[model samples]
Target: MTTTAEPPRSPDPGPVERETVPRPSQDEDPADTFEQRKGTRWLEPRLLLQTAKQVAISGVLGQYNDKRELMGGISPGGYLDLGGAGTRDDDGNLWLDYVSDLGDSFEATYSVAALLSRPTLDLAPQEGEATTTRRGRLLVMGGDECYPAASVDEYENRLIGPYRAALPGKEPDAPFLQAVPGNHDWYDGLTAFMRTFCQRRWIGGWRTRQARSYFATRLSDRWWLWGIDIQFDTYLDEAQLAYFTEIARELQPGDAILLCTAKPSWVAATDEDCEAYATLDFLERTVIRPRGAGVRLALTGDRHHYSRYEAADLAQRITAGGGGAYLSATHHLPTSIQVPPPTSRARSKSPSVRYTQGAVYPTPEDSRRLRWGILRLPFTTPAFAGLLGGIYAVLAVALGAALREPARGLPADLRAVDAALRDAGWARLAGGLADSILALLLGLVVVGGAIAFTQDMGRWRGRTVGLLHGLAHLALAVSVIRLAVTLTAEVLAVPAPWSLALVVLLVFVGGGILAAELVAWYLLLADRARLNVNELFAGQAIPDRRNFLRLRLEPDETLTVFPVGLPRVPRGWERRPDWRAGERERFQPADGQLHPFLIEPPIRIPRTPPATGAATSRTDEAHRMDEAQRMDEAHRMDEALPGGMA
Candidate 1:
């Protein structure tokens, strides 16, 4: 029997320690390789094609509705029940539960639930060796709980079902769940989110405890958690503001407050002058700061990563949106925001809280690692453009020779280049060959100039890029058609109608080329301000890792937060029996999680060092009590920004 031979393998270059390699030039396409010209931009033509289709659909249907005015209809007295009517568990046995970017991707939800169920070991601040497992009393979901849209069906499969499956032990006494609506939730007019979280509908054993999407819970006499619903950037209605005004009246001086909203005001407010938004500023003025609540902390979940910032006022901001969704980049945080260091070991005084700066992930901070991210872009834009360029070049040569016009630099007798086109029997168009070629070249220049001009234009940047991108594709198609028509009549030497039919096919191909490029542009460049899917889907270089924040309230009423960072999820995690498939069933678990929960070491909160022997004084207790009283009177503060619940 003859055996099939395996392909020959190249000899390994083996360890060359201390080797120096030059980085690719700035202008060079990162996807370029000797084996491929124009790079791997067309590597995932499907994604390009899909994006094109979506763009077309969006243009025709206007997929989004702006409800800014409508959502601003909140009533000042519209406060929701924190724990349903009158069930009071005011023993400070509270769990300030937090998760964001949830309600989508079943596998991711499953993994996140498993991760949350995984017990965490917390070390006592006073004891070097003592540790305990701590859990939250309430389950607070940040925002974007459902994927694609906020329809009830989407939530049933993508959000509630997977969570129930993952945390099967949840019972009537399970931590209460409260959420703020996100953009996706508002897509269906907040119908599903309202039903799931605000209608007190039972999801597993957890029921929604809010009358409206936004809420205020009395964590304790000295602590409270407030969740606001800024429905897709709409204003916080007067009712919501009025409810918080009442909350301010009940506040004690020494009490600490936690603010939870739908999106990260600090990160999302890139165009704003300050780190937070005008809405957040308004809220701080009207509600939070006015109460004199000590140690104000703002929690947001729109950005799918973990980031923490501290302003000079000691107010803390955090993004813990990585509850269960596609990961976002930490490097994309605006340069203006001040990130706090991970540990405060050297400081003499310990603040009431500490936060991790930048992103704390398991990935290495190496040059090669970052270079891979930059290279991902070429595959999306340049690669698609290259494929179109390649096709046009081939067609140009064929039609150019049929008309006897040599490509500008080539010799006149360069018949061997496209000798096959000579037999197309299009002698009549031979005289016009040179003219067609020149026109094609002119179109290229015009298209290039238009792109350059738009790039430099300051106003309407996104619209300009989109228009120019479309124009460039159209110019390419026009040039190709001009060349193809010359030969179309002769090739289909039947009736005039037959030749017309063949020409129409060529036009269809041109449309496909246009569609492909349109999709590529959106996938690669449309939302450059935030981390996008190109790096993971097209480049396939980075791992599918996620980061989250875990907050556990201490017995002494101090909040200790641990930034839990998960490693790159294994690709094979989808094979588990619990996995589901199809669009009718949700596509085969790619772009999501389906494995057992696993994570690197949890980032622990820094502790205050023990002090030398000292006795407590009644003055200290009296001072703390006085501070609590002062909190009740400090009401006229910063204006409050209308924020949201999921």
Candidate 2:
């Protein structure tokens, strides 16, 4: 054989001396490159108003748009091949990483992204044993990839920008990325989510593979992973059902599956009749189980915390949504729950499975202690406080206008009534019927809104708590007006026109603090009753206790899940020198950065093969029945909407 001339080899570049490089000052760096200085103020009045409007518009539009149906026209039966070709390790194993609810504050997002971007992680051993795990060849973003809402600009700034900076350059063996849309993602009808995640483009070093929002992928011969998009917790459309039904035809006798959904329906199922859990229960009973495939694990991330529950048979239902969002409360999580729920309309003979809460991040005690931070709402959520202050100011003006005047501007006939009203003490404030009615209407509106905000409890209980809360604010408003009138008129002897300014000032300042305190106390009391707990923490916006999961699939059909927690994300970062030369990542954590630790020991799940003979025969018969039912349903859908399918 003739030997070809080899290309000349370049000289080695040697190890980089990172400490010698001059770093850019904060002022010198571009504005876009810096991490967000603060977390999203969820309690901000303007943001809350904008988000509410978007939710209403999107909810109505999603009913008609149905983007998943459109995806069917492009690729009817498409499923990605994640395990094919160059994805396996030397021992034929596969590694995967899961993260969700990312794209909140920049510091938290970049902190998690930088840690996941590393090629390998040497985790601290549990009991003196050292273990090192490699980065996954696949990255699954479970849900809520961006927060508040989904849009091109929002994705670029809060999500894509940080992830790209974490791993700027593409490698030869870059991992594949896939995502399931959360409720927030559907706020824009999934336009941004589809364009960002479904276009087969690159998010930093990760490559996109799915042609649709929902995806099914084979991790190995014995394992499969399915992610389904249930927009707004609704049922899956017929096209999606058909897509999975076709994939089910290729399933073997004993394949194991990992189901990923946007929300933790099991947790929701514990409280109420969750439609999402009902849909998943139907899909699992009809499509997967009848084919002799067992769903060993279910993963979700909408709750923004890590909580794992296990059944008697060791089946895991995990919620690992703590990518980079506000910390959600875990104290209220149930210790035991039944999937499909007693209220669900499940058709199967074995309707529900009992799952006991196993491990939770931050512990219940810590979650309870964190709620105290909500007491600082006046400081943390100043805009919300200002909104309250503005309302109090209006009520103060109305109350002040209703007070009996000094018998000068009053009509001659009303002097007697004004004198009687003045001597009535607190009752004197209700003298003018028109202004009192206005104040009464405003108070009623506040009370109604507070009642509406208390979602976790029944209507009567919420109304009682809300009535107490509203009355507290009204009492404070009255007290402030009475005090201001005394201080300006009796003490300083100020004029009527100037006294109005003092009344506004005291009410706006004192009312804001006292009103916020009342809300905090109300939330604290209501939390014990499991009411408005989500708002209590969402208002706090705690950026720490972030977490993600790293999983490894072995050749022998065993999967190990490592839950990693970063208790405190680093706020300071330095630019790497190699990044300027177009080689490596740009920013890295500075000195005193905290290290990630395992929230708990690695959870191992082994696949159980299906039985043979009589069991196998029964499974085949059940599979046929399910298939026939699905076919009939699909045919009806086709008849109703002839142009609906591809």
Q: Which is the leading candidate under lDDT? A: 2
**Which lDDT tens digits does candidate 2 get at residues 207-257?**
766768898877876788899999999888878887776666546556888
- Report lDDT (CA) for all predictions: 0.49, 0.74
TM-score of each: 0.59, 0.85
Candidate 2 segments whose C-alpha is farther than 4 A from its true place: 1-37, 125-128, 274-276, 347-350, 406-427, 430-435, 490-495, 577-585, 609-646
lDDT of 1 by residue, 512-553 (tens): 455454444544454353223323333332334555556655
Model 1 sits at a Cα RMSD from the real structure of 18.1
Point out the worst 10-residue segment of candidate 1 by lDDT. Answer: 1-10
Worst 10 residues of 2 by lDDT: 1-10
Clashes of 2: 0
TM-score of 2: 0.85
